[model samples]
Target: MNRKIELLAPGGDVDAIKAAIIAGANAVYCGLETFNARNRAANLTFDDLLGVISLAHRYQCEVFLTMNVVILENEIPTLVKLLNQLVNTGIDGIIVQDLALFHLVNKHFPSLLIHASTQLTTHNEGQIGFLAKVGATRVNLSREMNLAEIKSLTRYAHDLDVLTEVFVHGALCIAFSGQCYSSSVSVGNSGNRGRCSQACRDEYDITAAGNKFPLNLKDNSAYFDLPELVDAGVDSLKIEGRIKGAQYVHTVVDSWRKQIDKFVESGKLLSDDSNLYKVFNRDFTNSFLKGNLTKDMFIDNPRDNSFKHANDKSNAISVVQIQEAQQTLSSDKDAIVSLVADKVSQLSIEKISLSLHFSGKLNEPLTITAVTKDTTVEIQSAVTLTLATDSRIDEAAIVKRFKSLKQSEFELLPFNFDGLESDLSIPFSQLTQMKNQLLFKLTKREYIGAVTLPALTHYPKLNTQPTLSLLICDEKDVDLCDVTDADIYFKLPESFKVNDNKYIDIFLRNPRLIPWFPAVLIGKDYLESVRLLETVKPKRIVSNNTGVAFIATNMGIEWIAGPFLNTTNSYALLTLQERLNCAGAFISNEINRNQIKNIARPKNFKMLYSIYHPILMMTSRQCFFQQTVGCNKPSIEDGCMLKCEKATTITNVKGISFAVDKQKGGYPSIYNHEQFLNIDAVEDLSHLFDEFFIDLTDIGSGSKAKIDKVELVSHFENVLKGITESKTSLKQLVTISTNAQYQQGL
Candidate 1:
């Protein structure tokens, strides 16, 4: 508390932004209707965002814009145009998820501060190093981390001069952020694209635990854990409610504001937190931060729990008492709304008003006095004005040249030309220079002209024919590697024993099996993985986790970025190859043919694609069986990750089902019912790739496929080898497959 901790609030709209500012928020983050994660929220327009930044700065509150969604190939031009305009807005920072943005901002727009979004799934120390290397000044830690984990990562980040922020109050996601594909697979709406359908909250058939909404978790509230977070050395305490209305934002931000103030002032905590309950929430829990993954963290209902909390707090047992409690809660909510409205009524986000007064003589320089209510700036043309008849500085020409000022924070009023004599002219270039100078003086920042990124050189494939690769996890399938000449990738588990040498011995014995790391690794698990990497000293490996990639890059080992890193645009490819020394990468399967066709590959870097694999819906550190088939353990234990091998299907009310599979030493994950088999990519874009990979592992199969693994590999290889008859045989072999994602790109 003694340290200056920032209180960051969410601004879904103009009112919410004003409410947070009036409620004593130190910073506010919001989106601008496009290229942000909260597309469902009432995001601000570009013009409104300019005014919001101006207003927030007046109150000493910083504004951070959210451009956190993955950028597609076609959107880069428009995104660059927006960035050019944003560099002059005095925005404090830009929160981003795409690696392409990091590369773009670091190389072209270095003046813009970059904050890594939670979608990056930053959990381990090496991931912090990775973010810092990629130019993130601050990082949003994954919500699943505990106090000790946070403290350790924060210390590491601080050593690198990077700040850390924690999500103290918000809705909790069961799956790790950026790793969830449940919405994308269930519907065409992808969470990565900010079109999540809330599949976790959908009604499902009752499980053995008698729960209908099993995947729903209680909202996260670390209100009482301020002291511990302070001890953890986090720089900011972020509140997540961009989807909530202005009233919710005001009430929650105000309550936390008072709590933070009291704690900072007296080092004593506030006990009453009833104000937070008056808003929308699914009850509240701090179990994740406590490192206790109990079943109680989940709520059977996903709606607002305020009414129930009130009735329980009032000890209402009878119907009349319950009715009275409900009435009181409604009245209190109304009172809060009225109070917030009154407080925010004093705030305004209107554009700055400007009045221009032009005065000049026949021989002196043409001077334009820019006047505002707060200040005035007088700028003159460099050259002396001269008498002219055909081209004079008239009101029509001057207004046309200065109209662009209205696009920014200033609104130009009617121009005044009475003091200036007619038939006096200056060069058009001089007029533009005066306008630029005036902008610099008014905004207190130098004007940045538009920048154009040079087009990357398109490298052609050295080998025209793409190679075939297969992925396998179990040692039983290792014998299949001898049958084909394709490269084999060995899948590693999410958890590792303290001194486990089982994987080390496997890699040492079979030099051809390349290690494939998963997307999520924390604390000891991450360290053990690093130990294996150092012990084996593999020539090459494929990694989905940035933490693992950072270690590999530091050790001078060749690494290929996995598809989960969400490589979509060309700049992301450049970031991996140029910055991280990555030798190869897999383009994301979330995009379609048109979106994939425009990406220019870097020289000497290989582009890989997955033509056949089971579609992963989500992965979680929490137990999925507790509310499904019913586990005897009250919570997940250390042994669960190394011992649990449970697989079950959860059917929704719409009659669609998804398979939940948990292998030993692996986190529980959900998979789409049908496997992904994109034969069209092979037929259409085979020339653009160097490798077409397939997962022959039984991780998500769950007794679905009866075909022999060896025969399936042969069929896929033959299809890739241009065997006319093998296409039909391959389709028949994998009957329950779809290529819908390839057709419906994000």
Candidate 2:
């Protein structure tokens, strides 16, 4: 028997949600006003979400709410309150990015289903195990994954009873999701906090290749890839346009719905995708899904390409033909809008009208009845009513007690008390029991009591004076190990030769150099990394990748969570320490001073922070040189990861320049114009951290002159020693530096 594949749609507003349901969406993912990734979308309110859930469920469509942002320490209380309310709202699942949410939902609110967000960058097999251990029931695979990779990962996930979702349509990010900090460093709008300014879509100075928007990629459309995805065992096909409107949602969902039904009924696919091009797009591409990274994936323009596509497909060379194409597109869009509006008009999400009746007689049991459009619930008090002068149950008392029903998905109408005797008395406890029963019958949800987490005990620092640490990539900087006693972490690239012992020898030769793992490691590279860990057997390592951390834990080797893991709150600390047995973790730099100060560390767990480093904006598997400097090769090959060395700068129209840098064995990456230097954190947050790190790796320099690694280590050490004069000297040494992130945090 073939399993049914779910068609998930985005709902940025109430109308869009209704449109999706009417167009045959199996599930719709929507966000409330706060804590969702698409902050630009017109999100729903709490009351609106209740109605949406009720309405979607009525059509057999599940609703998943997105709380997919990193949580700050102070926001934990509010987040908990929201979770408590969500438990009784009949929400199907919650899509989350923060590890703190995983801990809270697993420990306190086990009833809420947890789905891992794409922001976690889940690509490798070990990451599936890690997410499963953290209590995720479903995981949205990274959009960059190919069909083969998705199949293998999905198989592994299924072994643990976890489902997988893939982005079948919508806009694509140039960089890996959640890993990009371009908006955060440039505008103080952290994507982790749902405030992305979309720096990737900004118009830049024309590159050598003569492209204006070098980083903008064509929108993703997998309309013809349904069979392949189903064979790959993907559970849900997710459309990625939460910031889009109802017209776009209706057109895309309607198209996919027909396609899916056709394929399922007779194993035949719909040949036409014209309805898709009638909506907003930057054209379309399936290169990423096909495992081909080429220059054609990029689009010079970032606006809607519907009219342009129509004109080009018609081969319109004359102005009249172009105008005709535009008019046709306009007409098509309006037709879709009208069609969707009519279909959704037949549906309603209004609050259900509720009526209440009270009836009783002397020496008889008191009875209360509740009526709604769909349900009728009646409950009799165990105790009989008695005639009384004081403390009688009047209309005012009944109104006050049952008015709380407004909190549910019901609007209270006038009470029907004509059947009851006036001023009859019964125990208030009986009334409370009757009200609870009415709520249970009407909502069909058990009342889950709220959970209040106890405060985390603050642990004292093990070292009174935090030591300085340095990260180095090149072998030439190995001499710095002699200059400072601080821990020198050797940087590992994202790719490596299969069964190669090059890195293993490097680690064996230098035992004092702790291995530092990068965030992304896929396929053979991940296996090679595991082989290196098994061979070298280092005492300790710093890992930005959870896949490596999972293997390290299995080997009983102590692992320190790197900065890319995005640890922000106390529950996040508990997750690392308790679940993964992580020895320590680096607090995320994306947060502000106040947010950082409130984090409580687990007992005997080390905390670290980077005080000086180049700020990475974004990283991508696609070749940056192809779009910027015009590569001779048509597409990126495996050799490019181990042999390419390129650097260039692209200035935006706003006069802000970003450096695109690619190392010999790393992915093509973009860096901020200025390096991040937070000297004030040494004095302000020194006591909370055990080590302050400095990135001595000579990456992300772009066109700037390189700084001496020895001088960097010396100055950082002096500052850690409480030398105020060295702070000024260090700032002078690194002329292009900014601490804006420390001041204006997420």
Provide the overall lDDT of each model, using Cα atoms, as 2-decimal numbers.
0.92, 0.90
TM-scores of all candidate predictions against the true structure: 0.98, 0.96
As a whole number from 0 to 100, the lDDT of residue 61 in candidate 1 is: 98
User: What is the Cα-based lDDT of residue 401 in candidate 2?
Assistant: 80
- Cα shift from native, residue 576, model 1 (Å): 1.3
Give the per-residue Cα lDDT of candidate 1 at 433.
Answer: 83
The residue-by-residue lDDT of candidate 2 on 622-740, one tens digit each, is 88788788999988888999999999999999999988899988999999989889999999999799999999887997544587878878888989888888898888888888889
Model 2: colliding residue pairs? none
Output the number of the lDDT-best candidate.
1
TM-score for candidate 2: 0.96
Which residue pairs clash in candidate 1? none
Per-residue lDDT, model 1, residue 533, is 96
Estimate candidate 1's RMSD in Å: 1.4
